[model samples]
Target: MNSRKQVASSFTSATQIPISKEILETPVVTTIVSSSDEEEEMSFEADLWVSLTKTGKQKTPNMIRNDLQKYIDECKENGTSSQAKIVKSLAVDNDSFRKFMNPKNYPDQWSATKNETYWAATKLLEKVKHEKKSTKVATVSSARSKRKTSDSPCISQKKTKSELRSDLKALIARVHAVPNVAQNGGVYDSCTEVVAKIKKFLNRDGMTKALFLEAVLGGVNPHILAKFLAGKKQDQCETIVYRTAYVFFEKLRILEGRKKSKARNINEERYPQGFSLTKK
Candidate 1:
């Protein structure tokens, strides 16, 4: 009767073990799951990287997650949980990850630090950078070619002699010394010389009336000269010439003063006292 009771007790205990616990304790047959999952994720990254490089389009993590969800599910079903885990971690939804993946979508949030997806993303980013550099170089090359073609003397358009002469004549007429030229021989000579110089300047291909005025006026305001040339204001040639010369001379004097000051400092540094033979 005791032996019978022992058997009953053992059977009852065995039966009490939960079905869920048994399922948990059951060993899976897959042994290379960890290694296989890594390999699968690597393969997925390579394929995705190729897609990214070709399009130059930023892929959001959500978009990437959606695309890989099926593959991850299949891996998980196949007991390649490690591989699925890797893929899931790569597609982890976070602000930093999202910003890194689709920088164009969230430019302000963009960050470029090394992370779990750095290697895969770098493949695409590097390719994009190279393509942009190549495109920029090509654009610059095309622009330089255009500039060279346009700047070539044979290709450059030039004003006709008649047009140049007319423009120069108008420019001179605007700056002429009113009735002073008839009264003063010096004024008449200067006027004649100015006309001759303008004619010579117009005969050149590259020279313009504005350029000639710029040369004559040195650093003076060209717009003021332009106004006078346009006949919007009146000023005698003698007055304009005297004023320009005065300004030019004044600039020269200022420059000379600065040079003298620098020389005096250097001399003092060298001598340290009066250099004259007669002592104070």
Candidate 2:
């Protein structure tokens, strides 16, 4: 038994790998950042820009006016407000905006500026915000109705600190278990696949969009993440994953507060009975 123990210990010691400077300085796999309900998930502003650009060509004054009109109509149809006021705010007046929109009516001095293009896009985004709010309210209402129908309370019972800690640890482990960024080429292969994956894992285990956003804002810069996610270059996708993962890991550390708690515990232990033992 002694010989066997010695042999096992020796073998373990012999196989132990030394930690490299690179390994210590940088992490490979990090905690996964997840978002809350798909409806509540915040899209990168860059993604919004891409969508806006794809809507139509904004080079001409007419095109910009047309897009603005479409958005205004959409907002009004969706129970927003008066389009005239909105248009007047964007340009000088509703008639003036229309005149600029018409190729024949367009004045020689009234050239479409970058500011006009931006304003039109901004109005479109405002419409989108209204739609998103409506969707969120509907989703919450539906969920509540379903719970009431099933005779179950909509609110869940509170969990104990230990239970919360255990759950968090399990979630962290699950995050680590996901395939590495380098694997599967990092970027999503297809729209369908990405959507399905998000549905399956995004809000799972108390991982909410709020938490994801906090991590994004707290660690990896949100603007950088947005740029990478919105970019056309395929190579940038991996970078997004790495930055997101690193930030997520940092967020987990913050949420767990393990170090702070551990230190407190140590202090309590050393100062038991409210007395600190001083060296003689």
What is each predicted model's overall lDDT from 0 to 1? 0.39, 0.42
User: Candidate 2 — what's its lDDT?
Assistant: 0.42
Candidate 2 error regions (>4 Å): 1-130, 133-150, 153-169, 183-242, 245-280
lDDT of 2 by residue, 1-280 (tens): 2322332243234324676544422222111111221322332111112122332322233445666768778868987766776765454554555655565643421233322433344445544654688689989998987777679666566676567556755766555444433322222122212222233344455654444445333445556545544443233434444434433443444454434222223324444532111212
Pairs that clash in candidate 1 = none
TM-score of each: 0.17, 0.31
True-vs-predicted CA distance for residue 203, candidate 2, Å: 9.0
Error of 2 at 200 (Å): 14
True lDDT of residue 45, candidate 1: 20
* Ten contiguous residues minimizing lDDT sum, candidate 1: 27-36
Q: Score residue 167 of candidate 2 by CA lDDT.
A: 76
Residue 15 in candidate 2 has what lDDT?
Answer: 28
In TM-score terms, candidate 1 sits at 0.17
